[model samples]
Target: MNDQNRLPDVPLRASICMATYNGAEFVEEQLASILAQLGPDDEIVIVDDASTDDTVARIRQLADPRIRLIEAAANQGYVRSFEQAVRASRGGAIFLADQDDVWIGGRLDAMLEALATQAVVASNFDVLGGGDRPPIPRLRAADSGRHRANLWGIMVGYRAYYGCGMAFRREVLPSFVPVPAYLHESHDLWLAILGNTAGSIRHLDDSTLLRRLHESNATPRGWRSLRVILAARVVLLRLMVEARRRLRAASART
Candidate 1:
């Protein structure tokens, strides 16, 4: 999230927002891992991105009341699919999730604890079955409140802020929702931008989930061309400006 407020008196409801394409093979296991951790007040909001496979059917087969399934008429890609899930969510705490990952035990307790005071929380991850870790270095707890430093890290492409490892309070949604129109990818970094712009994000050192990498992943599996890298950097610069504007507008309203 580049998404929250700190009103402790209000009831706590966690919304796990997930986007799925053709994930029938692993969706059930992922959902089971997450559902086991959710309380009665919590929910799992999933948006299917027009999967031609049995993804939607697998979700419907669950028959869980805590699950809210939204079907897309056509393929809108994962970023907008996630945005739709977030906008449709009713929880005060929003957690971004990927369909192929398994939530580590106590993840909810750990992240919700961070969101209590910070607007956003980004945790670390381990590759499932002891596979190679992500190319970027993991976040350090010592750098939790260093928003400027974190922003620099994100811009330099070493912060490793994957959506599956991030969550935020509801108050910050206005800062990054309706994500930058040109962003056909890297939504996590966009959220990280707004989160750091507001100077309120917690970086957790511990791994909260086990990620499964596959060829069908929405994120590219190989290195991008230098031109693409430079283009993406320009987009990051634009997102930084947009984040500041949104944060200022939100502040004026308050």
Candidate 2:
């Protein structure tokens, strides 16, 4: 069935926000993989950040009416492009997509179901060997110092938020910080931390997204992947401290 003529019974509509740069190498394959998982009511918004390659032409070649392509005159990078895509979305639910990764079938279905009663639902991903080794989920230890790091806690930040498999409701979009200008690479972390304050973020451990580990990947997988893990930890710790200080200040005012 064509997604454009979607029926109304489906309780959810998913807007997939895809950001691209010089990703022509695998962008088509990635788009096809995602297009396959989409239900009748799903929508896709692809933001191209002025790719010097044929990425834009390749996307236009597919010409799927359901896919909306936005070309940036100049490169705004992934962070800004992603934000633009999210704002352009009209779906009741929003899912972020990476330009190079492949989504396992049924990923959206599982995540949407998991997020049914919650504010966000993120799934676990398996790393493909060609790029880098996948990191195991260690929520218990990661949550150690901060009590709010509990799966249900608001201070969990983006450390626990998996960008490849995360989805959120459309109404909450306004609360998100626009993709920051700083060179800090973890935009997902920033959104997740802010999201925690607005609503709940539930973990959907069943869905397995294939995280392709290729040298061309934005943060190519390898031993270096540990840097992202460590950075997330540091960010979470600072957020926790700030949250504590804010709470104390509120108490004093009260």
Candidate 3:
């Protein structure tokens, strides 16, 4: 571990914010994979949402000084837990992590390189399932085609951004955090929408993560009910309106 006293008080280069809940089955593996990629200067900020399982114990077993654990008083859902973790991070660039995924080697380097040019970037990832499943499609940004002029439109329409493969610079934090209570989308998508409107969201071609598929995933599996679809549409409309407002404000400043 790097000596903290010798380091400056300013934010570090990379701060990974991971939210975990009852993920003892594979959390250790995920942590080991990520920790191996980080430098002595990098840090991982983990927020556990009151896991009843041995997840906390397993994480503590790592005993790495770079890892900081924050135990939530109560069980907040994934969105809120992630919000807290992000808030607690002290890095100029933030990476999101899921407790069950295995990060590919060089993931941090690739993301940091992208962040040099883009305010927010997401990379491709291979899917992993138990017992040898076929390869899954790579995660990519949607092709806007005629809607290329509107980045937010492409994001809202395709919903392709995955948080596990995403990272963003600290400059975008103001627009990304304190996630709107009314938005029905996940924190990743909301940040993507804002990044797109800011003209700094990008998709890297490299696959830097192994996204594990399992029953414990917080993402909905298949088709959703009509009620869910309608709610999502409403949220999308609201997001679009806000994006437009911000764009106008930015244009005026320019």
Candidate 4:
């Protein structure tokens, strides 16, 4: 990483896109963690979803020129907020970030290295902030036994990718952005599905982020009952059908 105040001679290689909403409690720490790994050539683009708290203030306090903040006029959900950040970014590679999670050391370098060969890459992450009892069970593409097959199967079936641990090339943006209004999936999952279909999608066996589990997280974790799981599966199936339809339509246009 280069000095924050200095500019790089080369063009920016990576654009980190983050979406925030009332994330004042951990946004500062997350930003610091990300900043430590970024080079002078990299930039952070944040889209805040009309937060009523000090999330935007905390971000402004950083005062780093590399950090660009965009305040949304109305509170779009997380998916749309992320879409706005990605559209505003100016880098060959785009890394999705969550406002509350702390990134691990060497995350950017590792993901970029992986992205050189694959269209998209997702890394493993350790669950953080959960108490001594037990951490929540999050899926990883590597552990799901479906990476060799269509990677989207694992994503659509198991919901394996987390945005904070994922990165993709700018070329995939055409198919990813303006995320389909009918798909009821998170932005990360949508990207994973599209990236897998567009080119190669792989899982790096490194823990690239500390996934913090807290109450304020946009995607809550209490929906584990049998009926809830079934309903969720139905929703995922519908998303998969719609996603395939969109892919076909895109191919036809191309």
Model 2 TM-score relative to the real fold: 0.75
Please write out the lDDT profile of model 3 over residues 130-218, one tens digit for every residue: 35322334445553122244444433445456799899998777666677777534777777777776767667767788888888888
Error of 4 at 241 (Å): 4.1
* Best candidate (score: TM-score): 1
- Minimal lDDT window, size 10, model 1: 1-10
TM-score ranking from best candidate downward: 1, 3, 4, 2
Estimate every model's Cα lDDT from 0 to 1: 0.89, 0.67, 0.78, 0.77
Q: Give the per-residue lDDT digits (tens) of candidate 2, residues 1-254.
A: 12333533433488899889988888888889988988666778888899999998888888876687888889877778888889877789999888888888888778788667776666667665444344544233224334244523433333445576677887556554344445345566555554454346666645457777766766534554667657756665665454345435544665
TM-scores vs. true structure, each candidate: 0.94, 0.75, 0.86, 0.82
For residue 163, give model 3's deviation from the true position in Å.
0.2
Worst 10 residues of 3 by lDDT: 143-152
**Which residue pairs clash within candidate 3?**
none
Between prediction 1 and prediction 4, which has the larger TM-score? 1
The candidate, 2 or 4, that scores higher on TM-score is: 4
Model 4 steric clash pairs: none
Give stretches of model 1 more than 4 Å off.
1-12
**Candidate 4 minimal-lDDT segment of 10 residues:** 1-10
Judged by lDDT against the true structure, how good is candidate 1?
A: 0.89
lDDT by residue for model 4 (34-85), tens: 9999887789989999999999888998988789888999998888889888
